[model samples]
Target: MTGYRRVLAHLREDVLGVLEPGDGLPPERELAIRFGVARMTVRRALDELATEGLIDRLVGVGTFVAYPKRNIHVQLTSYTEEMTRRGMIPTATVLDFGAVAASDHVARQLRLEPGDAVLRYRRLFYADGQPMSVDENFLVPQHVPGMAKASPPPSLYRYLSEEYGLVIDWGEDTIEATSATPSLARLLTIDARDPLLKIERRAYVGRVIVDFSVSYYRADRYRLSVPLQRPRRAQQHRPVLRGR
Candidate 1:
């Protein structure tokens, strides 16, 4: 990275640590002199930070720290399902809904033929009126025909399980870090460059693949945990005997 960016990062971290909620930061000239950089560099850094919602920059005054992001728990379930299980009312606003030709990645994930049409649904989910996540899902139209016409329920899994008699027996998913896109950032009300958790999940009903979903979770809100177990000594290996 550039020296300016490096200094900016350090100052950003320091400011975050020292700043109380709503506390303003030092003046730009002071910051530049403190870091031995040009005032323009400090201004650029501050602009980046402000755009990310980490700080609120006032014109005549200095910048102030904003409230910390919310903490959201992520599980092996859909946003609506998980929130419902927690006794929270889950709501969804459909962002994009239509059929489209499967991309190579989506085709591979859903086991679809190249150029085959797939039903795509994108929705922003909320819990108790607060934005929780955005889910972009792709599925074979034959498997869930007329899904769009179906009474847009809160949970898709429940619809499949109850109405269609398709029980989700198992699923596999991968999670990684990503930056929100401009559209996604606007929907989630965060900065586009904000770090986020991206989950790619392929759900199965018995042995049949049902749906493939790519979900973007706000990093400040979501943390995923997986439990691991140690193998038993007997299962692991046999100890070598040494003659004394």
Candidate 2:
């Protein structure tokens, strides 16, 4: 291992792990002298620790230990369902719900003309009493009867299957890392430059598009994971597409 790595290992094992939150680490010069390494090596080690969230650095102050972040595995279920399965009390607060004039991009996604009607659903998803994500879903008005004036449903997928007989046959989703916007930061109670997970999805029932949703998930409290395995001989010959 490099001198920096050795120093990092020592700090992680013998120091940082045992330190309480807000406990400050030694200055870089002090660590360098103690470890018999260059000051640059100690600085690099501390930089990595800060990136991993095991330490927090305040300019003009010092570097201190911090609480570890929580990681939530991704799954193929509604927020309500997944949080419930994890034994967390999930709540969806409707921020805005009603029919709205559609934009050209929104209309195209729902297979409607630019001026066509669309029902907009905006909600804040909370789990274990903490805000986790904000989602905005735009749906084709005719597909969901009376949704234009109704309160936002707690579990939209459940409502569709049970009340409207529409189940999402398939969906296209894209996820990426982005910094929080001013509005999003305010709602999620995070800094504007904090990292976030952006999810854009379009759900369909057979050939008809149902809804297009864009969501921002708090990265500190969430993680995206996918299951993978060696391809089976038979499956490799005839791959079966799956969704998660």
Candidate 3:
């Protein structure tokens, strides 16, 4: 990376440790002098930070730290169940449902022809009357024919298992940081360059892959929690508890 890029990364990490709303960043000239770079280079670094939602630049005033993000947990459960458990009213707006030719990645995940038809289900999810995520799902049409015609139940997994006798054995999921696309920004009411959590997941039933879902979660609204493994020695050790 260039010196300016390095300076930007350092600033991002440093601010992340101590940032609060209304806190001002160092002056652009000062930043340039501190990093031994040009003023334009410092400006570019700040611009990058602004795009990442870490800082906000004002015309007359200096830059300030943005608000801290909301952290949400992600678990392997029906969306209905997850939202209800979190004490939020969950609502869905179906965007589209139809058969489409699967991309190479989707086809490989579903173990089908490279261009085989797959049923696509796209929906926007809301929590507490706020848009929280966009979910796009793909599935093998042969396994669930006429699913688009069927009135979708409250939860997709529940309907699949109950109506089709398909038992979802497990799922593999991945999460990472990404910038919101222009259209997605409009839908979520966020800046197009804001960071977001992108999740790609594939669920399986026995040996067959049942569904693939790509979900984009608002970085300020969602987080994932994963259980960590305990050491074997710790598990073997006994703990004494006093009677209540």
TM-score of each: 0.64, 0.72, 0.66
The runs of at least 3 residues in candidate 1 whose Cα sits more than 4 Å from the true structure, single-residue gaps closed, are: 1-78, 84-88, 230-244
Task: Give the per-residue lDDT digits (tens) of candidate 3, residues 41-76.
Answer: 989989998888788787777888875444444445
**What number of backbone clashes does candidate 2 have, counting pairs of residues 3 or more apart or in separate chains?**
0
Candidate no. 2 TM-score: 0.72
Better of 1 and 2 by TM-score: 2
Sort by TM-score, top down from the best: 2, 3, 1
- Poorly placed runs, candidate 3 (over 4 Å): 1-74, 230-244
* Winning candidate number (TM-score): 2
* Alpha carbon lDDT of each predicted model: 0.74, 0.78, 0.78
Error of 1 at 149 (Å): 3.4
lDDT by residue (tens digit), candidate 1, 1-244: 8858886788678667877756878898898888888999988998888777788776676688865554343334656556666787878898877788999999999998878999888889777776767888887888887886765555667777777777666667778899989988999888788878898878777668888998888766556655456668668432221000
Instruction: Give the higher-lDDT candidate: 1 or 2.
Output: 2
